[model samples]
Target: MYDEKRACPRVVFHAEARLAGADQFFDGSMEDLSRRGIFVATAQELAVNDVVRITVLNTPILDLEAKVVRCTDRGIGLQFDGALYN
Candidate 1:
């Protein structure tokens, strides 16, 4: 199998996140994170390319808007909108 190449920086951390537009909250650990993206594993399934708002643990005041890049049976990979950070 061919390995996918990543262009962004990734940092691992244990964090709590919630999906936007959904009232139900999920407890998941952050697999990786960067200023431009994040990867998280949760029980709920999220659609790829879906726009979502996520709040990281200990950073409640900073809600991030991101687009789903990949979705698996257990988790989601999100790409943050560059415009949101500027």
Candidate 2:
């Protein structure tokens, strides 16, 4: 069984993520969106604690500054800087 350790509810959706301040981008599928953070399923090479702009296309969240908290071969987990609502 998987335990939910999230503070906010998350919605499962696939979206594109653009790395801010870098000339790199990729399609982030199997994304879990929430007010606190998001997990994007991508093989993009990234390090922990790296701040990047996350633009969730086809969703309300866009141009959001987030820090990479977790990075694995499957994807990355980002903790957003602020609230996401629009």
Predicted model with the maximum TM-score: 1
lDDT per residue (tens digit) for residues 1-86 in model 2: 97887668898866666555366666676488888888878878788988877766776765778889999899888888887773
RMSD of candidate 2 to the truth, in angstroms, is 3.0
- TM-scores of all predicted structures: 0.73, 0.72
Sliding window of 10 residues with minimal summed lDDT for model 2 = 13-22
* Residues 1-86 of candidate 1: C-alpha lDDT, one tens digit per residue: 95647665566767777667345555566777776788889767777877877777777487777888998887888888883343
The TM-score of candidate 2 is 0.72
Q: What's every prediction's RMSD, in angstroms? A: 3.6, 3.0
The pairs that clash in candidate 2 are none
Candidate 2's C-alpha runs over 4 A off are: 1-5, 21-23, 58-61
Q: What's the distance in Å from true for residue 79, model 2?
A: 0.7
Where does candidate 1 stray beyond 4 Å? 1-5, 22-27, 83-86
